[model samples]
Target: MHNVSHGLNDIASILSNPILNTDSYKASHYLQYPPEASAMFSYIESRGGRYGRTLFFGLQMLIKEYLCRPITPAMIDQAKAFFTAHGEPFNEAGWRYIVEQFGGYLPVRIRAVPEGSVVPTHNVLVTVECDDPQVFWLASYLETMLLRVWYPITVATQSWHLRQTIRAALEQSSDDLTQLPFKLHDFGARGVSSAESAAIGGAAHLVSFMGSDTVLGVVAANHYYNETMAAFSVPAAEHSTITSWGRERETDAFRNMLAQFGKPGAIVSVVSDSYDLFAALDVWGTELKQAVLDSGGMLVIRPDSGDPQTIVLQTLRALDASFGSTLNGKGRRVLDNVRVIQGDGVNPESIAAILAAMDEAGFAADNIVFGMGGALLQQINRDTQRFAMKCSAIRLGDDWHDVLKDPVTDAGKRSMKGRLTLLRNRHTGEYRTTTLPLEWDERTAESDWDDALVTVFDSGKLLIDVSLTDIRHRAHAHEG
Candidate 1:
């Protein structure tokens, strides 16, 4: 072995130490990445070797594309050798860590109806199968991925539902839905998990709608939009610093902010509630208008305080009264130039109420934009009213076992056991629920079932090359 290092020293070192026992090395690696890897490995280990190879296999498949240059024979050989040389325990631990990072597998061969599909509870929209019996033990670990996947779907669904409701209300209540010009940004990073998940969740939202504050989310969703999306938002900075005498200073925040952002327009969101929302709007309205018009910007003032609905109404009235005549569009003022964007505690429920009040107050619907955070992307709650996950069937020995866990009441969840298949009506284009033996669940056989849940992933490998855009488009189409 050549001593020449190639930026792989750390990995190489871990692999070469003969005295480095598997458990110790595994523990060390766990310390580096922590809980996820260790926890998964520990769980798999608890089941003994039966699950270790399965776990390793799953992780290998999941990260191979990202980690391996091309998953060539040499690369695979190198990986297996490195892992083996590092000792089985460490190798297993590393594999577990990687799998945990990549997410889990789901049993139902699933082709999701896009990210924003308004999936109903008990609707097996996910196509799954016990296709590969060897990976049966993987079902448990797959739960993690399902949970992760479910969050984005749930959040996106809720947002899409709200958008749908908004659209419907506009039509029914004489409000123009077309007034919502800005994007629907998923600005929940400060409170959500890693940047990736936040961005992913944001991308999922884009499937049902558009707008995101996350750059990563833009990239993820942009792959589908076929256009470059940019993240135009404010920096996280305080204008004043605390001093001895309870002092206050402007510190040229507006000027400095102008310097950085310049003449802002195009979804320009400023946090007015930072100090005093109404007062900030009162003070900034003039400059904000000039800045927007001069810079060709539409100032969107984000009031993240008080009751979102009340604040939105007041802000809308203030902007309208102040700049209404100065601007051309009735409620859309182009002169004084400011739009009230409700954020902070703006969840779906609050949004619904806000929209209702704004309509009741005869507020300009077009003048308001939404900057959703916790409510949209935080996976608030499983509003799985129309959606659900159930065990269709469990295979025992050579035969399949059908088990149903019927909920005693609405509080008690129920599941159906045994191999089952979902059928969709071609004429209605809706999912038709039913159960049948897995052996007869083949769609290629020209089954009477028009809608069949096919396996999207098998043995830890994706069965298709569906893009995020595809998911988004499908979700949007389904919503329509």
Candidate 2:
């Protein structure tokens, strides 16, 4: 038995040892395949779910974080000890082979669609296969780790849909869409599973919007994708800060928030519903009215509790009544001094519904932005997008055979066979992002298809590097 007092990091230097990074059964998979099997092929895809299209992201981060490191004798020894205690067979010989022949680097090649391209569901996002004949199982052995792409992919997809939702609203109700990127702010760092999840998922949200409070995510984007300052945030007040002032001093809290962050043309968000939201609105419009007007900044009022659609409209009306408003040149009402940001229960559906309600009520989409917490990061999973990585083909001796799984229980779960090549759909090209597949290695200069899948990694080294700036640009390429 392992000692309970020992920390997880003490059990093993998990990051350095790729051996302990997978399912327990994976340790025994080396012996399960036919002895003659010389190579294996696998592919990852979104089987189809909430949205028909998925914005590819975070593969560069994954490659740098996991696959780039070479294996060592120490990792093999640690893995053997772990599998022994857990009653699983160890692949000592295979690990030794990798260390000796490949200098501890994984003898596998990976092909992935560029990180920012949007591809339809039921299509290939990444493919993997062994580079060395003897280590064929290495391709699929990495499944447990490689399949983690689903999280960032799912988050990016959800964020993109939200972007589209906001864009539609802005087009109909605002004179310009310049504010679309900052419309949905990320307040989800503290609400995610771990720091790593916060970083990955937070960076995913930045693919569409530039607002985030997850500092680690910005750091990660710079470290992994070579982009510094991937997102931005401003001084914001939380419930603790507002409520800590005591109920009687609520107005004092609002005043302090402005004094600290309300510089010229700046923006600060303050939670305004600690006591009575309507009452707070009254104070802002009357006693503190001139203070706000002379502050030379935007006061973004946040309402923490209520039905979002109703509260957002209510908040907008109150702010407008106090500061007054003006119709822009395009004829939509714009708030003069203050704006509302609905942070409670702000999901994609609720955001769309809120905007639709505002449009119906003669309120411009610019009158309010949104701050999403749980819904932005933690409220999703692999099944949210039906993500899967399945073995599609295998090489035995000199022969290649198509591999697949077709369950009688659910045809939707049927897997792919042979190998795949991701190519641009030349006929329906928009932003050069539309994708279609062909049999493996069929792409040619003679044909019109531009190969979207790239050899991003191989032999434990990063072959192709794409930066976060490049990814963000590609992700929004369709916006033009």
Candidate 3:
């Protein structure tokens, strides 16, 4: 191997190393655990936040990307040197032991609810435990990384709730629910913090919809989740493209968009709010009205700056004046070949509000869709679902000790205790978190019938493989 090292004054590696993926404080955690603690049992849960449920996802992506590979001696050395200089303790001997004894595969087992399963919060979403007595700290050590899954889970949950809102509106106003999946589009790639954030959060949104402009998210779903094309986008124009033409020639830019992309039976979106949004609407409502009709493709009008609900109501009325509307079977007006896409300031509340206002105005839900950006991907935090991973139980010699924390200050911060497993009722389908030995050993008859948890990873090997298609099917199963 070529020694491409820059000398001691060298910049730290920007490349991803499993050793450096965590908070620096985590490097000293091995020494902090109980000395006699032979093994740790920890579980992840969403304590409840913006939503009551979470769409558990992105775990397979994490496992395939980080844990499947073996740890290298070089990694240990690099981490040691970095931590020594950074004023933190590094568990060198423990990491070396992992390399020597386990050939670098982390001696831990991970079990989680099957990916794409939407379960209520305050339940076990994932559990981790050390597979070796020597690596008792492995479970918590992985917390800093494992908890990152909350990003995708929360995104998926938000997206799923958006889907429910859209579906309800469609049911009330439209003749069919076929267009529901594409109703909430992902316009969030550039709005997020990182490319990986775009990728994972984008993929999470794809759980409920097929409409997205976030290309890397489509690639991630294809690469990590075995999808051919998990999401899709139509030819659309941004503000830069429309504004590139001088302000006086706004209609010409809108005309050029149609001339370029409006093929028979195709759909295209154009951002119309670069200048005077209503003025642009006036131009489209008259000068380009005949051109839009003759093109034989759908023209999605996007209003980029306004109160989404109010703007949607006004846009629908403007489009109705331009193009005649026919009432659907449900007695709501559906605009012919023209639709509005409200992309500004969209979130769960705004989406529901827009749909409700549409219902009040006798407009069909099919007359509009939403394009969500920051709110869909980057606007949330771990506390959006109040996610936490805590050691609930530990093994010391022959006895298992149950552990828990009930903070008197905040009852919401209280935690559960046990070597835990989640079980579902065969008849009611409600889930319950129960202790292992009592449930798995003594009450095996009941749990064996309906254990909701599945072991997906064991001893650094992925035991069960899942695909995007299967996950999508499971996610949509409850809908019909």
TM-score on alpha carbons, each prediction: 0.66, 0.95, 0.95
lDDT per residue (tens digit) for residues 318-366 in model 2: 9889899889765778899788888899998899899999988888898
Q: Residue 285 in candidate 1 has what lDDT?
A: 58
Q: Give the Cα RMSD of candidate 2.
A: 2.8
TM-score of 1: 0.66
lDDT of each: 0.47, 0.86, 0.88
What lDDT is obtained when candidate 3 is compared to the true structure?
A: 0.88
Residue pairs with clashing backbones, model 3: none
Q: Which ten-residue region of model 2 has the weakest summed lDDT? A: 430-439
Q: Candidate 1 residues 153-188, lDDT tens each?
A: 555556666677666545544334554324355677
* Positional deviation of residue 221's Cα in model 2 after best superposition, in angstroms: 1.4
401 Cα displacement, candidate 2 (Å): 0.7
Q: How should the candidates be ordered by lDDT, best one leading? A: 3, 2, 1
lDDT of 3 at 225: 91
Clashing pairs in 2: 71-104
Query: What's the lDDT for candidate 1?
Result: 0.47
